[model samples]
Target: MSTYSNDVFLVGTLYGQSAVSVSQILSGAGANVSSTALLGAVLNEYNARLNDPAVQNAADWYSSYRLPTHQEIIENYNEVAALSPTEQLAIGKLGKLTSYPVMIDLGPGNVQLFTAIGLLNDYKARYPNSDPLNLKSYENDYSALAADLTDTFSDTTVKFAGLMVQKGTEWGSNNVANWNDLSQAEKNAFAVFFYKVGENEMNARLESAGGNYVPDLAGAPIAQEFYSNIEGIDSAVVNSFGSWWSNALGSEQGFAEAQKLEYYADFFEQNPEAFSTNPMFLNHLISEVGHDGLRQLANVFDWPLCFAEGTLISLGDGTQIPIEDVRIGDVVTSYESTLPLGRLQNKRVTRLFKNEVAHLLDVHGLKVTPGHVTLCGDGQFAGKHVPIIDILLSDGALVRENGDLIRMAINKPVGSREDQFVQVSYAVDADAAREGNLQSGKMRVGTLLFDRDDQPVSVLDCIQAEGMTFNPKTGLVTRAGGSPEPLYFFGELPRPEDYILRRSRETLEGILTDGEWEGTPSQLVGQRLRQTYSLKLH
Candidate 1:
C-alpha cells in the first residue's frame, strides 16, 4: 500500500479505535479495500460529530469521535518527509507563516489533527515559480528557515540547509557544484548577498555549515572581475573589502592577502602616470610603508631657511664680541650714516626688568644688526648714542647733547637711515692722557647747548661772574642793574666782586624802605640779592 494509506491507517488506529477494532472494521470492509474505503468509517464518524449542533463543546465532540491523536500528527509529518524535496520546500514555505497563529474554539486534539492535515496538504501542492537560488525568502527570514530546516531534517546538517533549499534542490553536499549550476542572475544575487554579509560573518556561517563554499565563491571569475577596478582605498576602505573577502573565504589570512592585492590594484588604477615614472618605489610606498613614511619621502624634494640674533660688535673697529661683555662708554661702529662713517660713541647697558626685547623687536619689525646707531637730538646739539632698543620703557636713557636731553618716544620709527651731524665724545686712555696732558679729559667742537627757542647758545657766554643768576632749569642768566660788568670765564667759574655791588646796594635800600622793593627796579634788586646770596653759598 502507498505510504499515504499506511499513514492514514496508523492515524486512524491511534485515535479512531483499538487495533483489534480497526482490524475488524478493515476485515468487514473486505480485503483489497481502497485507502479511502478503509478510512470511510472513521471519516464518517468524525464528520457526523463535527456537524452535530448538540456537540457544541469542542473537547466533548473530539473525545466522542476519537479523532487523530499525536501519533497521527507524527504520521502526517512522516508522509510530508516522503514527498519530493521541491514539494517539501513548497510545504515549508506555506506552513511558515510570518506571524503566530490566532487561537480558536477548537479542542486541542482536534486542532492538532487539523494542523497535521494542513501540513500534509501544503506538501502535496505543486511547487511555485519562485527561484529558490535567488533565496529571497530564506534571506528575508534566515533565522526562521534555519530553525524550520533543523526541525524537519532530523540531522545536524541544518547548517547547510539554506543552500539545500535553493534551486536544483540538492541535499548532503557542501560544495559549489550546485552553486555553479545556478542561473547567472542567481549567481549575481549570491555575490550581492556575500558582499552585504561581509567576510567574518559569512565565513563563520559557511564554516558552521561545513562548507568550502567561501573559497569557491571568493575565487570565482565574477568576484575577481567585480573587485578589479576599485580605487582610493584607505585603511577604512581596506577593512571593508577585507571583511567582504573574509566572508567569501572564511579565512582571515586569505582576506588579508586579497585585501593587499585589491589595495595595490586601486593604487595602480589611480596613479597610472606615477607607476610609469617609478613603479618600484611607488609599490614599496603603497604596500610596505605608511602615511608618515610617505611624508618623509616627500620631504626629500623641499629647500631650507633660518634667522638668529648676532653678537655684540665694536664701534671703533668691526670686531665681534660677546653681548654680556659689552659695557657703557664702549664705542661701536655706526649704523646711522654710511657716508660720514659715523660711530656709536656712547654705549649704555640697561638691565630690563619687564617685557621681552625680542618680541618687541619683532612687533616693530626692528632688527639688531652690528654698527646700528640710533640718532638722538636735544636742542642745538645732536648726539650719536647707542640706546638699548627694547620693550622695557624704563631701561634706556635719552640722548644728551651738552646738557640738553633728547627724549625717545616709544612709537618712533626704528631702523631709519636719516642722518643728523652731531658731536661724538670718546673715552681718553691713560697713554693718550699722559702723552697729551690734556686740560680736559675729552674735547668738544660742536655747539654744546641751546636757548629755549632752540637757538645755539655760545659756550663762552654760558660762563659768567658771580651775583649773576643762572637758572639751569631754563638755561637763563641775569645780573643786577648797573652792577660791574660780569666777568666771563671760558670754561671757568666767574668772580663775585664785579656783579655783587649793585645787589649789595639794593639790599641796603630795601632794609631802609620797610624791607620792601617796588616796580621793575625792586624786582631786579631782589633777584640780584638772591643771586649774590647763592654765589656766596657756592
Candidate 2:
C-alpha cells in the first residue's frame, strides 16, 4: 500500500485554535510543531485544565469513590459522550485516572508502557494546573496520583492501557503494534513514538518517562540513511540509542543484525566502493547525528564549537581538525539553544588543513556530473550563509554577471580524502564552473528528478530531457508535468547535480538557507541562474 494513507484518527487531534488542523499540514511541518511550539501550548492547556476547580473536584471524588473498574470507566465515558465534545474531554480525566489504576494491575510490557507514557505526558502538557488552583497544591496531588499508579501497577502496561482508554479516539486509530520490545530502529521505522509520565506531576512533567524512554528512532542507524534524505531529525545527539532495542530484541547478535542488516542489504545492492568510502559512511554518519542531533550532542558534551558562526560549510570527515577532534558522530548545538541544528546546517570536518582550496559550484546554472556532492558556499546577506561544495568536474565553467564564459578550475579533487582545510570558498564564476579552462576539462550538465520509487532523482545527459514547471502565483507554466523543460547547460557536467540543484534552488534560496546567498558580498552565480530559468515544482 502507498505510505500516504488518509487516517486522521491515527495521527491524533486538531486541538485548539490554529490556522489549520494538524492533519492538514505536511508531516514535516506537523512533526516540527508537535515537537516544538505546540509542546509548550499543550503543556499550558493541560496545566489550565488541572487548575479548574470543577475538574479537580471531579478528580478528587473519582479518586475517593472506590477505584473504578475498567467497565465502570467505560460507563463513565458513555455518560460523558452524551455531552459536548469539550465536555467529554473534560470528564475524560476521570476515565484516565481509572484506566491507569487498572493498567498497573495488568503489568504490561515496554510497548504498552511506552504508549502510556506518551499519553500521560500529553495529558499533563494539556492540563498544566487546576487554577486559582495553587500550582504547588495541584502539583503535589498530581505527583501523589502518579506515584499511586506507578506503585500499584509495578508493570508499565497499566499506563498504556489507560492511554488507550482515555485517548483511544486519537491513538487507538493508528495500527500500533506491541513491537515485542524491538530495537529503536524498528520502532522509529514503524513510526512508534512513546514516552513515560507519572499519573500526575508538575514541573517538566512532559519529559520522557522512566524505563519508558525508547531510543529515539531519529537517532537509529536506519533513520540516518532513508529518513534523513526525506526528513530532518534532531542532529544534536550522536545516537547512543539507549537500551530500548537491545533489551527488547534480546541477544547481542539480534541487536547487531537489526542495526547492520538493513545497511548490508544496501551494500549488496550497490556493490560499488560507495559503501566503504569514508564519504559514503560520512553521509550515513551525518544522517546518524544529523545537524540537530549533533548540535544537541555538542551541547550535551559541552563542546566549544558552534554552527551558527557564519556561512554553512562542509568539512569532510577527518578533514576538519577542530571539529573532528571533538568526535565523529557527536552533534553540536547552535549558539543559542540546546536543540540540534539539522544536517544542512551541520558540518562534518572531512579535511582540516589550512590554505586548502575550496570550490563552490552553482550546479543549478552549469552542467554537473551524476554524483557530485555540494556544500555551503561562502557569501553572506541578511544574516545567513549559503552552500559551497567542491564540484566533481575538474574543468567546469560558469557564467558571470556580464554573461561572459569564465574558465573554472578544480580547487580540490572530487571525493578526495586528504589532510586539508577547505574554507568557505565561492564557486568559481558560474561561467567558469560550467565550461573548462586551459587547465581543467570540459563541464557537463545534468538533470534532477526522483525515479518511480521517490528516491532522489539525478540524471546526467539531461541537456535534452523533456520536463515541465509550474507557478502558483502567476498560474503560468500550469500545463502537465508541473516542472519546466527545455533547460540549458553551460559546462562539463558535475556528478549528482539534480538533488543539489533542487535543494539549493528551492529551500536553500529562502526556506532553508534564509536567502543568505541572495545579493551577498560574493554573489552566487548559480542561484542567479536558477532564479532566471528554473521554475518551482513544489
Q: What is the lDDT of candidate 1?
A: 0.30
TM-score of each: 0.13, 0.19
Model 1: per-residue Cα lDDT at residue 401: 25
Give the Å shift of residue 168 in candidate 1. Answer: 2.9
lDDT of 1 by residue, 1-538 (tens): 0111222222232222222332243235331112212122222222333354244232322221221233432444456546654454344322422211111112211222222233223322412443312223433332222222212111111112122122111211234446656654345334333432323345466567677553354544433432331221111123322343344335655546444444434544543222211223333343433434343333332111011233344545556565445544556443344333233343333211111111112211223311122343432113433322211112222332232333232222222211111121222356644465333221111123435775434333343424454433333335766433222222322121111222122222233233111100111222334455676798
